[model samples]
Target: MINRAEGAYLGAVRAFQNPMLDLLHKRHAPLVVSVLSACFTAERPNVSVADAHTQIGDALDQLRAAGYDESLPIGTSRDLCRQWADAGWLMRQVVDDVEVYRLSAHAVDALDVAGRAGGARARVSQSRVRTMLDAVERLAQDADPDALVRMARLDAEIRRLQQELDRIQRTGAVEEVDDEQLLEEAENLLHLARELPADFARVAESIKSMQRDVVTALRQDERPTGEVLREYLERAQHVMEATSEGRAFAGALRLIGDPQRLDGLSNQLDVVLRHRFTGRLAPQQRTELREIGHRIEQGLDLVFTTQREASYVITAQVRNHDPLRDRQVDDLLRDVMTGLQTWMPESRRGQSVDPLRRLPVAEVDHLRQTAGDLRPAQPPAPLEDRDDAVVDVTSDEARAWGGPHYAELDRHLVTLADGRSIVDVAVAFNAAPEALRRPVDLLGLLELADNQGMEETDELAFVDAVRPDGTRRRLAFGGVTTRMKEAVDE
Candidate 1:
């Protein structure tokens, strides 16, 4: 007794409320989609929470630099990620005991939509029509309850194939699909493949939901254990069959599960990439075609891993179901909630409680005792006098290993600056003793020049300095000129 038009209008409203549609229709849809596409890919579908913050923070900086300030969401990367998780565009879960952020099914769907929108439009071609025809025919043949109709359809298909084979054998020539048709079919296949990630994500999400339901049911203890166990068994067996998306994924898995089929797909993709017609395709398109098989494999692996983890968690919970413990924990939580409710009004009026940064230390009554000795068993021997050891005070090699003689250099510079208003640092450096002519000494001279407010000139100058190992080398640096003290006073 409902009007079809009103029902359709209400349905559209509900559909728009879906996370995927919300993502697509949001004001910052472009920003959200672009950021997600850059962050998550087939190669890296999940990012640790910390890494997500850093990468997205850097991405926002780049966007702002590229003039997207007005379009960017407010708050830090952590805030934005939390918001996205709350909005159902991102899934925040623990993977390998580490918190990570993964693109939700809704987010993946939005990305697929964005990717297709940015790519070349799918044209209405013979390849598309043929694909539709083939799908419809196969579906009819499979769905036909009458055996005669099915047999007749198969007979016609067999005869047509036989005719083509006979003609090919007679002419020794095979019909080649043109470049246009091949490209069309390749694009169509890629278009279908693009949805695999979203589909796989949905399946994983559904399994997680089932896990939550099973755990809740187990904890509630409202039903008998036998009934709950039976329901769980049935759900576990049909986890992949529980939803339409999961069923489609199961079918895909069956098709791709064969190693031989995957290998054949890889070989075909390689051959296609080598074809001259593929040159017309964009680089992204070509790369996607090459990776289609691997992408499907990764998606399947993710889903399987998710299923196993969910099953393990649920099974463990079932085995460890403690109704009394669960009830006690629920009571404690409710008590806490009641206290919070009582305190919230007071808090709103500025009565606040200091939040603990960490758990307090526990108090203990007694401590363990330990005894140690700082004194040695026997007294250590006194230091020996080495004044009788030979010494080489005048060895140039000894001085070479020591630091620069700053006092000697200062006196020498004063002597050089005596009637000259300006002194060139390189000339003074070259005239100094070998000990003062070490590279360290050259650096010392530059520091002195710099401290005297002498700016380096653009002209290049070279200084010959000896290394600690007795090797001499020439080094080039900017010309530095320092004025004498007398000149500065004048």
Candidate 2:
């Protein structure tokens, strides 16, 4: 319908050649279109031609060709001429006793534009029809002789599409066009299968798979590679299950043991998988694809649960590194990430996770982004400010302690450089394997007043505790080791 409307408008917009003009001469369209066309061109006045021609212009000849005899039905050529004059498509005048009907500039301009665009639209429409017909020809060659009927059907479809294009051109718009080329392409391939000998049919079955695949590939927006495989396998199985007794590719798959062909298809699959998966799949998900346990057990035959008859023999041949296969792994990773979000406790984890430390970059970024604790606090500004103060020092503790937290008696355990126990150094250190027994010993303190060696400090400078929080707090580290000995001797 849209195409029809467009075609109608397109015809109205352009000027017609002799044949087309003949078609439109007495039609109702010329009255309106002639005026609109006039609005588009420069005017020419006082132009005269010889009376031996016995006519005004080519437009008059068109009406005459359309049987402008006095015997016509509703109105004869005279009556129609009067109508055109009234409608402003033409003007009547006399000079030297010769009548000349001149085209209005409006009519001329509309005709010129309409003619250009209309011709262009016609050309494009013809091209599309040709393309569709080419596909039909291929289908005819491959399908059963009886399937020739399908070619005719496709031709009809092309004709319909051509008409539609014409209509759209007229209207200057095309919307909701269901013109997926693959749909017909698949049918064309299928036709070849139907016409081929059994030996060829075997290969044809595999090719027909292309048709089915096109339907899926375009429809799925975010479909994972593995899921696609799974879909293909299931589809094959369903088709096989629906019809029985024939051992074919769609039915038996054993016919596809041709090594070269298998390699080619497998390579294609590899390309698809590489594009879709890559490192995109996470470790856990990757692990899942490697697991043969989840798949139905088969000896020697490897099945891509997705592709029908899409299986291979487990020889020394290399495994297919299809990005698509990795999609399963990728999806599983997303699921794990989302699941951990709700239940997992905060710790150090990341692309480089120290299971012992539990710090993840994503989690860290989340903390940085989130507003500090909004809950009521002892001081009222929200205790979340304090949350930033606490560090998961175990992350640094590993540099300090060398291994997972060990009990103090284990002998290697040591305290922080401060008096605080190693266990107390980290935010969750209390819950860590509690193994610390003592704080680190302290040495005497001195100030480097300038670039000189150093400046001696008063005994008071080396206090048992120095305030880290700005306010005075008696947080101690260790007793003076050598300073006390010197002082005692003094």
Best model per lDDT: 1
Q: Give me the displacement of residue 274 in model 1, in angstroms.
A: 1.7
Q: Which regions of candidate 1 deviate over 4 angstroms?
A: 1-4, 331-490
Stretch of 10 with least lDDT, candidate 2: 441-450
Taking all chains together, each candidate's TM-score versus the true structure is: 0.68, 0.15
TM-score winner:
1
Worst 10 residues of 1 by lDDT: 368-377
lDDT of 1: 0.86
Which lDDT tens digits does candidate 1 get at residues 23-44?
9999988888988999998889
